[model samples]
Target chain A: MIAIHGFSPSGNCHKLRMLLEPLGQPYDWVEVDSPNGATRTPEFLALNPNGKVPVLQLQDGRTLTESNAILYYLAQGTPFLAEDRWARAQTLSWMNFEQYSHEPYVAVARFIAGWTPLDSPRRAELPRLRERSHQALAVMERHLQSNDWFSAGAYGIADIALFAYTDVAEHGGVALAPYPALRAWLARVRATPGFVPLPEPDALAADRIAQTA
Target chain B: MIAIHGFSPSGNCHKLRMLLEPLGQPYDWVEVDSPNGATRTPEFLALNPNGKVPVLQLQDGRTLTESNAILYYLAQGTPFLAEDRWARAQTLSWMNFEQYSHEPYVAVARFIAGWTPLDSPRRAELPRLRERSHQALAVMERHLQSNDWFSAGAYGIADIALFAYTDVAEHGGVALAPYPALRAWLARVRATPGFVPLPEPDALAADRIAQTA
Candidate 1:
């Protein structure tokens, strides 16, 4: 069995769970409290020198970091990944967009709103973050207008990658009302077989998220 | 020949040139002046709705966005990408790190210094960007200390991805002097067969980079 070192509320970490459950691939979940400086410790640094989470560790102790890469690794030889070269490249393109263009704005905004104190100075960034989040959302909306899935030709890892954060975007005050196509696509994703939603934020994060919104 | 819509001086765009040259693949370069708002034009948006450069257009009119994904596509079935699954995944992991952790700070700092006016308020971000840039460099240095290349078991697209911004980091006032291993790795990458350095910034931007540095 593979072990995943993750934070429950992080959409990046949740991405792995979303894929693993659907594939019925049993794995161990070793929770890491990323918000409270646990990832900064020496022990965690040994696992990943970059100090982020959702690391996939195999039985022999080899580990893989970066959620999207792990998704690609696990999805290979399964229908979760495509054999067509172009389709695979397109799948990767959307995953790259998720990490670079989408996650930095969408997921970071959620992190600030739900993980920080209400009066934290970082709150100053919300307006700009939300604005950027909408730009990313609009790009997804445009794509969704023509295409039903980001992972080329089907709902696969790319859909799982984008769905993790986009579903919880409202927690960051990024509204779904503006993108009808994106919302419709999200509903379609949820209706897929073996689908599982990300867990709701714990009480403290929920309170902060509510206050921030 | 395929067409590449790119900006010459951009590391993201340069990654493609680096790989294509090594593979002896012929290509058409359609220069997009991204800094001067060329990417914002309606004509360019039809090519890539996300409005970014370094888009790869197949002969049939299918287009691919995201620099790393394009690299993966162009490198397929070639020695530039690994054949083994684990090696390919690790190669992708490093490429993901370059985009998510490295490029936003290192490349953006270079953009701000070389492209923005010396008196532009964006200069205020330089210190923070450079600080984050060094943190990213440190991670690369640590990796290079243990291994010779970022791409698993070879000098491949992952190296091409990281090399683009890192080679010009000093333009952004992110000093390379602190990390000898990283500097050595840059030298090693340049020594690879058919390596092509990114074009120098044009005169106006060059002057700004000098002044900012």
Candidate 2:
């Protein structure tokens, strides 16, 4: 069995659940409170020097960090990943885009809104983050207008990767109403077999999100 | 032959050159001046809706975007990518770290320094960017202490991905003197077969980089 150290509400961490449940791959989940500085501890740093979450720990204790890479690894030879080299590469392209272009704006906005205090200086970043979040969503909307899935030929890890954060983008004050195609695609992803939705934010986070959003 | 649309001075664009030259892959380089708004044009957006560079266009006209994804696609079945699944996953983990953790700070700092005017307000971000760049470098230095390469067990695309910006981090005012091991690894990568150095910035950019660095 593999163990995943993740924060329950993080879309990056939730991406694993999105894939594993569909594949029926059994794994243990160890929750880490990232917003509270759990990821910055020395023990967590040993597992991933970069000090980020959603680390996949094998039974043998070898670990892999980065959510999309873990998804790629666990999805190998399964329906969740494509065997075609081009499709796999295209899938990776979307995953890379998620991490670089999409996640930073969309996920960080959600984090600032939900996890940070209302009076925190980080709140100043929300406007720019929201603007960039819309830009990323526009790109996704353009793609979803022409294609049903980001995972090349099917609903695979790429869809799961993009879906994780996009589903909760509204939590960040990034409205989904402007992107009808993206909204439709989100509905389609939710209907996939063995789908597991990301957990709701905790009370404090929920309260903060309600206020900030 | 495949066509690679890239700007000459970008580390993200340079990553493809780092891989293709070593693989002896035949690719036509169509230099796209990304900084001066080439990527924003409707014509280039047709090639990559994301409005970024280093897009790999197959002879059939299908295009793939994202620098690391292009490296992964071009290096398939070659020594540039590992054969073992775990090794490939680890390689991807590092590439993800490059785009998510490293590039946003190191590469952006370089861009703001060299491309923007000296009085540009973006210069205010340099101190924070430099700090984050060193933090990333420290993680790499720690890894390099016990490992010779980031591409799992050998020098591969992961190395190329990280090497691109890391080799030129000083251009962003992020000093490399503290990361001796990382500097050594950069030398080892430079000594690899068919290595092509990143091109020099033009006169105006060079002058800006000199002042900022």
Candidate 3:
């Protein structure tokens, strides 16, 4: 049995749940909210000194942190992980892109608008964040215009990483309507067998989008 | 032939270079200085929508950006990438850690100290950068204390991703002396077969605690 400690609203956390659902793996859940600083507590800190959520306590009790890491763990050897060398490389390419390009912009923007108070000090960052974030989304939209998946022709960890934030990017004031291809890709991923919706409280909106064309 | 666009001083960029040296692969180097905004050039941005350094251009004209992605691409199907399932997950775990926890701190600190002047506007971010950067280093110190290598108990791309920034961490005004285990791990990586010294602007001063240890 594995244990996941993270808040449901978080894209990083949602990514783990997404992969776990597809893998049909059962794991205990412990919520660690970032705003409440649950991850900073001594016990959780011991597991991941970095103090971030989506830490997966493995079957052996050796804990692993980082959302993408957890996804890769569950997805490997399943139909989700690519078999070809270059295809596998492409899988990681999108994963890296999510971290470097997509997540910083799109996810941060969402957090600012959706989680933080309207008058919070973090609001000042919204303008630049929105600009940088949309720039990244446009990139994804362009890619999805031609390719159904981020890499190769299958759903994998790469899609899970990008989809978590991207599907609900509007919460950050990002208008996904402009990106038709990205919207189409989201539906395609949702249609994957054993696909799971994010466990977030207001996840209905995203789930509907995912299931719809 | 692959074309890699990156600045020599960048640790992430060097991650790709270090691995390439070991593989004996020849690649065309298109120098891109993010500090100078060279990556923002239209031609470069066309290849990489993110406009970041370390974009790998494949022979088929498809471009791959992000350092770890390139490393995975160039290293796939080899001993550099773990062949076993669990080992592969471990490798991804560390690599993802490099992105979320490690890079944002250590890599950012490096950019601030090395790329800009002490009094530059970007230096304003230093205080927070410093604390978070050390927090990340501390986690590494604890991990390196027991594990000889990350994932598969052998040297892999994770080490290369981590080593690039860690080896020259002092450049970012980050001190590595307190972390004995991490320091020793650096030494082991340095002594590994096919290790390539990072290209320095001049010569690397050998007097640092990181080198001396």
Candidate 4:
């Protein structure tokens, strides 16, 4: 079984759950909650020195950090993965764009708006973050206008990598109304087979309580 | 021929050229100096909506952007590329690390320090950039301390992604003294088979002028 460590609240951490449910892959889900600082623990750091969430521990006992890397490992050679040369390149390109453009603004702003207290000192940066977040959405809206998908003529990890933040962008004060194409894309991804969403904190707590019992 | 649209001084652009020369691959190189506003032109923007450099155009006229993606496509199935699944995943992990952790700091700082004038507004961000650059180097130093190579037992595009900025890091005011292991890793990368250094701007210009005449 693969062990995934992350808070369910994170769009990045939830991406794997979304992918794995559709693929019918069985694995252990370990909740490394940010509120309690589980991921920063020494044990977790040993598994991933970077001390980030969504570290996948393969059955062989090797752990891989970096959310996108884990996604690639899970999707490679599967039908969900792109096959053609340039198409695969396209998948990577969007993933790159996600890290640089989308994740920085949308993801960070969401963290500021949703996860962190609004009155927290970090909220002071929200104005800059919000502006960048809108620009990111604009980029996505433009590319998605012409194509139904990010790459390979179908849905793939590129969509997954970008989708998590793009969908939840509203929590960060990004109004997606101007991006009709991106809005449509979000609906399509939500409709994808085996798509599991991040469980609300209460639902996750119930699951944990059940497991312990 | 594979046509690389790039700026001479851009480390990301140079990554492709460095990889191509080692494998003895022939490619047409087009200069795009975005700092002077060349990349803002519609013709270039059409090739890459993002207007980023290091767009690789194939013989069939398909343009692939993102320097890392281009590297993977051009080096596929070559010894410079990894053969197995795990090695490929590791290669990508480091590449992703480059984008998220290293590039934003090390590469961006290089642009400001080496290219922007002292009074240029971009230069003002250098203090913050330097802090992040050291943080990034610290991350690399720890990784290189245990492993001679980043991914797999041998070197791959992961090295190329990092080596591009890391080798020229001194230009950005990042001293190599704190990272003896990284310096050793740099030596290992340079000593690898088919390694090539960036073309001097004046030397490459002279060659271009000669070819045009």
- Output the worst ten-in-a-row residue range by lDDT, candidate 3 chain A: A204-213
- The list of candidate 1 runs beyond 4 A from truth reads none
Query: lDDT tens string, model 4, B1-213?
Result: 889999988889989977898889898989987788888899998898777897999899888888888887877888777878888888888888888888998888767665555556776677878788898888788888888887566787888899999997776777789999999999999898777886544543334323321
Instruction: Tell me which residue pairs clash in candidate 3.
Output: none
Error of 1 at A124 (Å): 1.0
Clash number for every model?
0, 0, 0, 1
Candidate 4, A38: how far from true, in Å? 3.1
lDDT of each candidate versus the true structure: 0.94, 0.94, 0.79, 0.80
- The ten-residue window of minimal lDDT in model 4 chain A covers A204-213
Total clashes in model 3, counting residue pairs 3 or more apart in sequence or in different chains: 0
- Give the backbone clash total of model 1: 0
lDDT of 4 at A97: 84
lDDT of 2 by residue, B84-138 (tens): 9999999999999999999999999999999999999999999999999989999
lDDT of 4 by residue, A89-196 (tens): 888888888888789888887676666543468777778888888877877888888899985679888899998888877666777988899999999988988876
**Please, what are the lDDT tens digits per residue for candidate 1 over residues A1-213?**
999999999999999988999899999999999888889999999999999998999999998999999999999998889999999999999999999889999998999999999999998989988998998999999999999999897999999999999999999999999999999999999999889899999999899999985
Off by over 4 Å in 4: A200-213, B199-213
Clashing pairs in 4: A22-A194
At residue B12, candidate 1 shows an lDDT of: 97
Q: Model 3: per-residue lDDT, tens digit, A1-77?
A: 88998888898898987888867889998987776788888998888877888788877988777787677777767
- All candidates: interface RMSD: 0.5, 0.6, 1.6, 1.1
Error of 4 at A162 (Å): 0.7
